[model samples]
Target chain A: MSDTSANRRQRVQSAETGMSVLKALARLGGDASLTAIAAEVDENAAKVHRYLLSLVQEGMVAQNAATQHYHLGPESVRIGLAALRQCDPVRMGEMALVRLRESLQVTCFIAVMGNRGPTVLRIEEPSLPVTVNMRAGSVLPWLWSASGQAFLAFSDDADIRVQAQAEFDAGNEAQRSMLAGPDPVARLCRQVKEQGCAIVIDTLLRGISAVAAPIFDARGRVVAVLTALGASNGFDARPGGKVCPQVMREAATISHAMGFGPG
Target chain B: MSDTSANRRQRVQSAETGMSVLKALARLGGDASLTAIAAEVDENAAKVHRYLLSLVQEGMVAQNAATQHYHLGPESVRIGLAALRQCDPVRMGEMALVRLRESLQVTCFIAVMGNRGPTVLRIEEPSLPVTVNMRAGSVLPWLWSASGQAFLAFSDDADIRVQAQAEFDAGNEAQRSMLAGPDPVARLCRQVKEQGCAIVIDTLLRGISAVAAPIFDARGRVVAVLTALGASNGFDARPGGKVCPQVMREAATISHAMGFGPG
Candidate 1:
C-alpha cells in the first residue's frame, strides 16, 4: 500500500482498537479496571487507561472513587434506550410471543435480521418441563434454522442479503455449503410465500423442529419473524404438530395487528 | 492558569467538542449529515465533518450510500445494549412495573436516582382512558416527587445522596429550597419510611397525585422507586386511589422477589 493509504489504515486500526476497548468494558457488565479491560481486549494497560479516562469524562463510563473501577454511566443507558425506542420489531413482537407461549405451551421467539446475521430479539419459553430453553440476543446463521430462513425469505433488502452471505461464507466449510447458492434466499422466499411458513426439521439441532412466519410493520415492511420451537420426535406423531398451524395463524394475526394485512 | 493548565484545558475543550458532536447526533436520532450536525451543535462544518469521519471509522456512526447522512452504527447499539444489560435497576424495575400495572389498574413507574435527578427507568400505563401518560425515560426533580422521596428513604449510600443533592440544588431557587437542610434527605427518608410510601401532591405536575414505594435489591441496596400516578382531582374522591395500597404491596412483593427483606 502507498504511504498515505498505510496512514489511513493505521488511523482506522486505532479507532477500531478504541471502540474494542469500549466494547470490552461493556461486555464485562459495564464495570472494569484499566488492567482488567486491557487483559480482556489484549491491549496495553496505559493506552486502555487513557481511553477509559476519556470515556469517563464524556459521561459514558463512571469510575468508582473507592474501587477505581469503571461502570456504564447514565449517558450510556440513555443512548442505548434511544436506539431501542426506534426498534418497532421488539415492541410488536413481545406481546405476540407472550400470547403464543401461553396458548401453545411451547417456546416462542422473535428474531430480527441483524448486520451480522439473524439474532433472537426475544424468547418466551412456556413454563413446561419440555420447553425449549433458548435465550434472547443469541445469533444464528441465515441457513441453519427455521427462524433464519423465515427472516431471509421476507427480507428483500439487498444489503442484508450481502452481509448475511458474507457472514455465512466466513463460517466453516461445511456451514458454507449449506448457505451457498446463486439465489438461495430468493428460493426460500418462494417457499415461504407458498407455504405461508418456514419449517426446519433438525437442520440446526437434532430432534428439534420449528415453524416460523414473517411479521410486518405498518408500512408492510418485514420487521421480524416469529417461531414456535418444539421437539421433532413427537411433532408429526402428535397432530402433524397440531400447534404449528395455530402458531402460524397467531403470527399472522400479530403482523396484521401491527398494520400489515391480507385484509 | 499556568501554561500546562492551559494545555490541559485545551484538551478538555476538544474532548467536550467531540462529545457535543456525538450528543447532537444522538439527539437527532442518530442520523445527520455534517452540515446538519454542524447546525445542530453550532460547530464549524469542516470540524464537524472531521469528527463525523472519526466516528465513522470508530463504528459509532455510518454513512448511508444513498443519502450520505450518518446513522448510528450497529456497534453503537451494541455498546448501548451492553450498558443497559448491566443496569440491574431497569431490569428488576421493569418487571415490577408490569406486575404493578396489572394489579393496580393504574399507571406504574420505576425511577432511579441519577446525577441529573430522578430518571424514569420504566413506565407501564394501565389500559384506562384517564391513566397517566408519562413516558419511560422522562427525568424529574429529585426533591419534589414521590419517586425521589422513596429513593432518599431507602438509599443509605453516601455517593448517591451527594449526587442526588447536587442535582436537586442545581434547579431553580424555589426548587433548590426543597432540597436544602442540614439533613433534608434524612427527614424525607424518615417520613417515607413511617408512612410506608411518599405522597407527592402537586409537586411535579399540577393536578397530579402520586404515591411511591422503594424497591431494594438482593443486597438490601435501594435500586428503584415504584410509583402509582393519577390525576389529583378525582384520585382521593373516588375508589381509584385505593390502588395505593395495592401499589405499596406490589412494590414490596417485587422488592422481595428481587431478594430484599424487612430487616
Candidate 2:
C-alpha cells in the first residue's frame, strides 16, 4: 500500500533563510541591528526585516523599540525549556559529571547521538582547566573519539547504525580499520556493552585521553555518553582502573535518574 | 525627544496564533497531526499547514513523512540549549537540589517566575519517592506558595514588584492584608530577605509543607527559587531546623553557580 500524505521532506529554501536570520541574531550575542543581522546572514536588509517581522510576530524573536534591535523573546525561552524537558540527556548528565569532576580534578563532558553525529552537549571543567577547544555543538566522529565510540558501542538502534555506517564508509583508510579488518566496530561495541564503558587515549585530540560511559534511558537505550578528558600523563582509562568504575557509577546514577531500573 | 521607532507592545495576532500552534503541539505531547494542532489552536487546518511549513523551514518543527505528524525539530532544541546556556538558573539550581535530596532523602524542585507565575522547571526526587502532585511546568501562585514568596521577598527589581502587585491586587480580601494592613507583604518580604527563606504549610495542599530559598543572578537579583516539598509530619521549615540550613546552603551554592558572589 502507498502512503497518501502530501508532506514533503524537502524544506523550503526561503523559510530556511528566514530561520537563518534568527540564528544570525543568536550568534551575534542575541541582539543586533537589522543591518548587522542582514550582513551576518548575507541577505538584503529589507528581506531580513520582513523575516524579522514574522519572527517578532511569532514570539520567536523580540525587538527593542528604542534601539530597533532584535533578540530572543520570552516565548522562545519557554519553547526551548519545553524542548529541553522532552529528551534532554544534556541536563540529566551534567550533574553527574559535576560530581565526577569533584572526585578527579579533570575536565568532563557529555555527548549525545544527534542527527548528524555524536555532538557535545555540555562540558565541566575543574578549577585548573585543561586546554580543550571543544564546546557544545562540536560533532565527533562515531568510530573515532571515545565519546563517539561509547555511543556506537552501547546503541542498538537501526537508525543509529545507518548513520554510523555512513560515517564509516566515508572515511580514511585508518578510519575504515575501526569498522573492519582485525578489530571490527561490531566486536568493539559488544565489548563496550559488556563492560559498561569505553576508553581511548591520544586518538583524536593530541596528548588528551578520554574515557566515556554510556547513559541508558528507561528502555535501556543509550541516550547519552559521559566522557572525561585529561592529559595522558596522569589520567588512567584501563578496564580495571579508578576512572572506569567512577564513570560507570556516575553513568548508572544518571541512568537511574532518567528512569532506568536498579540494574 | 519623542521616540521615532514604531514598535508596538501589542503582539502581531497572526504570529501569536502561529506560535500557539507550536505550544499546542508541545501541550499535546510534542507531536500531533495538523488537524489536531488546528483544533487545539482554534485555527483552520489549511492556515495551520502554512504556518507549519514556515516552522518546518525554520527547523523549529518537523513533520514525519509517513504519518504526517509534527513535532519539535533539531534547531528548536539547539535554540533552547543556547537560551539555557545564556541564563539557566534552572540547571544551576538542580545540581544543588540533587545534592540536597541525597542528604535529606526528600524531593526538591526548582521554580522560576515565568510570565504567568513561578513555574516548576525541574524536579529532583529520591528513589523512595514522596507523594507529590506537582511536576515541571506547574505554575505556583506568587502570594500563596513558598516559592512565590521567596521570589517576592528577595527581588528588588521594579518590574518584579509590578507583577507581584498585580498578583496581590487580584487576590481576595484576606490576601490584601498580606500587602496592605497590619502584617503587610513588605514586612513579610523584609523578614524573608533577612532569613533568606520562605515556608508554606497546609496553604495550598493539605498535609504537605514546602520551604523555598531564592537563587540570585550575577547582579544579586532573584532569578529562581529552590523549593523542598515533603509531608508535614517529617519535614521542618523553621529557621534553626536541619532542613532550612541545607536548603539555604544549596540555594547559596546555586546562586554562586548562577554568578552571585558572597555579599
Candidate 3:
C-alpha cells in the first residue's frame, strides 16, 4: 500500500510537470526555446527538453529549423478557433461587436459570466484617442460596473448567481448589499425584457458610461452581453451618443440572427 | 538496419496519428469523446485514449464533467493569440479593412502572398443584401485578381514574382503573354509609388472592382495591402467608379497609422 501510494504521488507530480510545461509555453506566447521554457517553469532543461520532444512528436509543438525555436503548431490555432466557435454566444456576439465598433467608432466588448465574475471574451476598438484597450480574457468582478450587471441580469443559472453573490459578499459587503437590493437580478431582467437595453453610468470605470444588452442564443438563453463604452461626458451628445441605440440594435440583430425571439 | 528503419517509420506513423486526432478534434469544433475522436480518426479507442491522457495531463485538453467530453483548454487561446500578435502585419491590415467595410458599406479584404498565390487573410462585408461571402484562408493565384496584382506590385521578393510567373506560364501561352507584358510588378510599384494606390477593374472577379494600397511598416517595408471591393456597376457609377480616390485615401490613412510615409 505504501508503494502504491508513492507511485500515485509520482504520477501526479509527472502530470503536474507536463501541465507546467504546456502553461509555460502558452505564457511565452507559443514561442520558446527549451532553455527558456525550463527557466519559465523552473525545471531542469533536460526534463523540459524531454517533455518538449514528446509534445513535438504529438504534433502540438513544432521546432523551426531556421530559428531553432519551438512554436505552437498550426494544429494549435485550428483547435483554438474551433473551440471558440463552439461557444456560439461569444462567437456571434464578437462578430456583431466588430460591426458595432465599426459603425459607432467606439469600443465594444462581449462579456460572459465566468467562475470569478464577468470575463471579457472580446473587445473591438475604433482608431480613436480615447479608445479603450481592453482585450479578450480580461476578468472583472460583479460589483465593479455595468458589464457585471448586464451579465447578472441575463444569466439563468441560480447556482451561479449564488456563487457570484458569495464572492461579492466576501469581497465588499457594502457593494454586495447594494447589488443584492430589491433582487437586482430580477429587476434588471424585467428592465432588459421591457426596454431591450441596459444603460449603465459610472458603474465599472469612472467617467465611462455604457449601454449594454443581453445576447441570447437560438434557445432564447442569454449567453453573453454586448456593451459599448466611452467617456461619460458627451455620451448623450450625439442622439444619445451613436453607441447606445446602435449597440442595442446590433445586439438585437445578432440575437435575431442567432435565432432568438424579439424581446 | 531494417529494425532501425522500421522503428523510425513507426514513430512517424504515431506522429501522423496524433496530428490526425488533433485535426479531427478541431473539425469537431474542439469537443470530442475518445470514441468520437477514434471514429473520426479511424483509430481504436484505446489508442486514442492514451493520446488524450497525454493531452489532458499537458493541460491542452480539458474534460467537461457533465458531458464527459474533452475541449480545448484556455492555454490554447493564449498561445494562439500570442502567435497572432507577432504577425502584426495581418492584424493591422485586418483592422483597416474592417474600418473600410464599416464606413463605405462595401466589401473589404486583406490578402497576402502565400506559397501558392494571394491568400485572403481577412474579409469584412457591409450589412447589405449583396454582400460578398469570400471566406478567410481562400487562396487565389497571383496574376488572376486585383489583390494578386496589388501584392505583386508591392512585393520586393524577386523569387516570388518568378515563381508566380512560372505558375502563370504553366497554364496558357496567351494568358502568360498577356501577364508578361510590361512587368506588372514594376508598373504596379511605380504606380503605388506615385499615386499611393492601385485600382483594378474586372481583372480578377467578374462584376467586381477593387482599389488597393500598400501598408508599410515602421521600417518602411510594404508588409500588407488594404483593398476595398465593390460591385462593378456601383463602382463605375460613382465618378470614375473604377478609380475612387477616397478608397485610396482610406488605404493611405491605414498605411500612415501603420507608420508609412506620406501618400
Candidate 4:
C-alpha cells in the first residue's frame, strides 16, 4: 500500500490503550488505587501508572493527596456535562420509534411534559398506519392518556399534580367511574408506578389499546414517555403482552442515551 | 540505559494528541465537522481524521449519519455522568476552605440545604480563629443567616419558601423589624438575588460579618453555599470589598469544578 493508504488503515494503538484505562477508571466507580486500576485493566502496574500520570496531566484523572487513590477529574465532569447538553431526547426517541415500529408493527410516538400537558413530540407509523387522531404537538390528557399516566407515575413535578387535579375535577361521570376511587388520580398513579409502565385498553380512544414507558435522565427524573398503540382487537395492552416489553425496552434504550443508568 | 528504563521514560504522544482532539471537540460546543475540529486543534486534517476514527471506535465520538458532523458519543456521556456522581460538594468545599483560610485569613465553612435548614457540613478555621459558637451540623435560621439567604435568593425549591414563611411568622419584634415590610421575605429574597451574593454584617452573630455565595451543580441548581467570616469591625463585607469578590470567585471556581459552566 502507498504511504497515505497505509496511514489511513493504521489505528492509534496508544490512544486506544489510553481510552481503555479511562474506561477502567469509570468501571471501577470513578475511584480506585493505582494497583486496582492496573488489575482491572489487566495491565502492568508500572504501565498503568504512566498512563495515569498522563491522564492526571490532562486533568482527566486526579490523585488524592492523602490516600493516593485515583479518580476522574474535573475535565471528565465538564466533558460529560457537555455530552449531556447535546443529548437530544426528541431526536433519540425518534430513532426508538422507528425501531419499535419495525419490531412490533405498531404506531409509536414520544411525548414530553409541555406547558399544557404531555405533548406528542415525535411519531413513527408502521407500513399500515393506525388511524389515530393524535399527531405531533397533540396534547394528551393528563388522566386519560397512557403517556400522561407514565409521567404521573414516574415524575414528581408539581405541575403534573396541578394538571391531574384539574382533570379529576372536570372528568365526566363515566370517566371518574373508570378511575374508580375516592382519590382516583392518586390511585391511577399508584397503579402505574407499581406496574412500572402504563397500559390502556380502549380508555383514551375507542377500539385503541396502548402501552407507555417513562424515559429518565442522569438525575433519574422522567424526561419523556414512549408509547405504542394499535387496534384493540389485535393489540395486546397487558403488562405481559408482546408490545409492552418492546415499548419499555425502547424507552430504556433512549434513557441510556440520555445518561440514565449506572456509569 | 536499559530498554525497560527507556520505555518507562517515553510518553505516549498519540494518546496526548487524541486527548487534545477530544478537548478541542468539546471546546467547539461538542459538535463540528472534521475541518473545524482539525483547525481548532491546529493539527493536519489527515492526522485528526485518523484520531477521530480511533475515537469513534472507542465510542468517545459519534458522527451524524445524515450531516456527517462529529459530536460527543454515549461513552463520553457515561463517563461524564460517572465523574458527576463522584463530585462531592462537601469534600471540594473543604479544599476551597483550606485555600481561603490561607490566602484570605478568614474562617470559612460550607453549608448545604439539609432537612432543617442551611446546615454547616464542613468548616475550616484560620490560624487566628474567629470565636464562632457554631460548628459542623449547626442549622442556621432561614432569615438571619447569610448561608440561608444564599439559598433563598437562588433556589426555587418549595420547601425553602415554606421555611422562610415559618421564620417570618416566628421572628421576634427586633428580628421582625429588621425584616420590615408587608412581605419582608420576598423583599429580602429580591435584594439578595439582585446582589448576587448574600451579605450579613453582625446580623446572625454580633461582631461577626460574612459573605456567602451559592455553588451550583451541572443542572444550575444551588447545591451548597460557601461562607467566609471574620470580625465585622475589621472585615469588609460589602460587595465592592476585597472579601466579597474573593468569596464569590471561590464559589464560582468550585461550581466550575462541579461542572456548572459552559461546555
Pairs clashing within candidate 2: none
Q: Tell me the tens digit of each residue's lDDT in model 3 across A65-92.
A: 5567876654454555554455466654
* Per-candidate fnat, comma-separated: 0.25, 0.19, 0.23, 0.55
Task: Estimate the lDDT of model 3.
Answer: 0.63
Q: What is the per-residue lDDT of model 2 for residues B128-192, given as tens digits with 9 covering 90 to 100?
A: 87687899999988767889889988877677667766777788776565455564667768877
Question: What DockQ does each candidate score versus the true complex, computed on alpha carbons?
Answer: 0.10, 0.08, 0.09, 0.35
Give lDDT tens digits, candidate 1, residues B175-246: 666554687766777767887788877777777888887777644677778888777765541223576676
What C-alpha lDDT, on a 0 to 100 scale, does residue B3 get in candidate 1? 34
Candidate 1 chain A, poorest ten consecutive residues by summed lDDT: A1-10
Tell me the tens digit of each residue's lDDT in model 3 across B11-92: 3344345445656876676788878989988888877766665555554565655577877654444544444334355644
Measured with C-alpha atoms, the lDDT of residue B232 in candidate 2 is 84
Docking class of 2: incorrect
Among all candidates shown, the one with the greatest TM-score: 4
Q: Spell out the clash pairs found in candidate 3.
A: A145-A203, A145-A204, B235-B241
Segments of candidate 3 deviating more than 4 angstroms: A1-20, A88-263, B1-23, B50-54, B87-263
Tens digit of lDDT per residue, candidate 4, span A1-263?
A: 12355654766878878888988899898999999999999999988887887677677887777689998887888788778888877876767888888988999999998988899989889899879998999999888889999999899988788788898789888777788868878889899998889998888898999899999986699989999999999898888888988888889988876767763
lDDT of each: 0.67, 0.74, 0.63, 0.85
- Give the runs in model 1 whose Cα sits over 4 Å from its true position: A1-18, A87-263, B1-18, B89-223, B226-263
- In model 3 chain B, the worst 10-residue window by lDDT is B1-10
Higher-lDDT candidate of 1 and 3: 1
